[model samples]
Target: MSEEGSSYDWAHKAFLQAFLSKSVMTVDEIKPILAAVMSARDPNRPTLEGDVTAPLISSTIQAINERLTSVDYEIRSTKDQTNKHTVYALVNTTSDSLTQLATTFTPDAIAYIKRVLDCMFETNNTRNREVMAVTSIQASQLAKAPTRSRQSQVGGDEDSSIQAEAAVKSLTIAESEKVLADLFDQDFIYKSRANYYSLAPRALMELRTYLKETYNEPAGDDEDEPAIVRIRDCDICREIVTVGVRCSNRECNVRFHDSCATQYFRSQRGNQRTCPKCKGEWLGDLFVGERAANKGQRRTTGGRSSNVRSEEEEEEDEDE
Candidate 1:
């Protein structure tokens, strides 16, 4: 047990139980849960909604995490890729794919999921077109596709052939759809309006290390080095930036979350922003995901009214 375990109280336990039930929650969502737990603990001094401050919640989570450290379970937080809203989730610290998804899925289902992930992160995600998402059609096609051998050698080894043969038994379209729906229901992945699937905030938070190690290459400070980096982090927040802006210079891999780019460019002095890496022009317009698809439409911050000034315009206004 951790040193803080002695200080753990009934309220904390109750909060943990509530958090465990959902596994993932937003800051706004957690406030009510904490308030309810506190209110139930002491009816005489019922905790009102107004009583739950950011500091109070932070401290409670801190204490809870301390106790959780001993058990390899933690309540982690990250921003949603689309909306940029903060999200919190109780995650297993174990890094393996088996430990992460095996709790809920069978061996074959897990294999199918692995293939989907491979499509999302590797096959589809590229320098020229960094979609970082898989469409329903693409996912369905994967069900009928043969599993690639794991071996790297020129002649496939016996073990590699065995692994491929034992890989996900050819799932039907219905089975594939069911798996996708289950993943969405569990908050591991989310389906966009266009039927595109990407990693959810909960998955990003829990599988941060796993994704980085599995997809991205070792970090190198040298800008000239042509590293095969599939999964890239935001220049500002250092978190994964799947649906975000990329540098105009294709060679320069610096990318930023739309919200992060707005805040970052707003701080810069000139109208012509420069890439932090290559020092080339930062075309504030270039983007990935839905933003890339809807290039003709005017972009708004935080999904606010379209009448509102664009992020670049707002930055320009502040400069003046």
Candidate 2:
């Protein structure tokens, strides 16, 4: 019952209903269920009322729809309607569907990742080297086959990834890149200081154990730090900040760690400073679900993105 309607129970219920329905739901179809969750008598206070009727959840409907993505449920534009306003659809998603490479990623991308991770747990030995190098060739093969086309304009950071993540009849190499980008964005993996990519610290620990048990790989005296993945530098501190918040502005989407954001905010005379790029206002609550931040809509330089479509987009040839 928090301000953002942070209710795990409600989200679970929505997912269950959609899972049981066994049908892709347009925004229209999912409205009632969203409304039912909002039908609570008083959002602030807890009560044991029986059945209740309340207004629709329109105020935060878009937010709710976007947040649902964190739990494998996502909203996508109704393909084929390019001339009209953007129409959305709800879907249940999984990791395999995201990258379109569940079967395998090239020759040994997965194996390579597992090896580097397992190497860390064995012993911190090396020529001061760690993390995996995502060479251009490796990235190409690991990603997949070629893509149809690409979109130059970015409506929002998440827009491109969402399009790639949707359920598809076929997979492509371009979508593979998008999947990797999402993984980086979500902290599943990160770039190393050595100008290469590797698994994140958390994944290193979790997957390290899994790989050891699953593959029975013996430990070798390879040297490196605790985690395979390393955090990038903070925009403000010019130092590595493992955890941070990013500005939403397109031009100046600088990310700052928790302390940095606080310090920066205070340095500006306790007034929120606008982003240096795009001049967009700084988001108050930096910690927010990226998908739900903008009501599941696309925002571009021109403003709310219209029917601009990507060239490589699938299932968009016909009107629905």
Kindly list the per-residue Cα lDDT of model 1 for residues 1-320, writing each as its tens digit. Answer: 13322367888888898777886898888888888887886778777778887777777888889999998889888999789898988988877644667778777777778788888887766554567788899899887647564533467777767766765487889988998999898898989889889889988888788887888876468887645788888999999887899987766789999999999999999798999889999876666654543424323334544344443544454342
Cα-based lDDT at residue 93, candidate 2: 52
Q: Write the per-residue lDDT of candidate 2 for residues 1-320, one digit (tens) a residue.
A: 34434444555356445534532334454556554554543466433223212222333444555667677655443311112222333443543332323343542344333333333322211111111234334454544322421332356466665554341223355654665565566444665454344444323222332433442333456654232322234567554322345565422336565666777777775465766555578874342112112223223334434344332221232122
* Candidate 1 off by > 4 Å: 1-6, 145-148, 151-160, 219-226, 290-320
Candidate 2 stretches with Cα past 4 Å from truth are 1-109, 115-186, 205-208, 211-320
RMSD of 1: 8.5
Task: Evaluate model 2: give its lDDT.
Answer: 0.41
Q: How many clashes show up per model?
A: 0, 6
User: What is the TM-score of candidate 2?
Assistant: 0.25
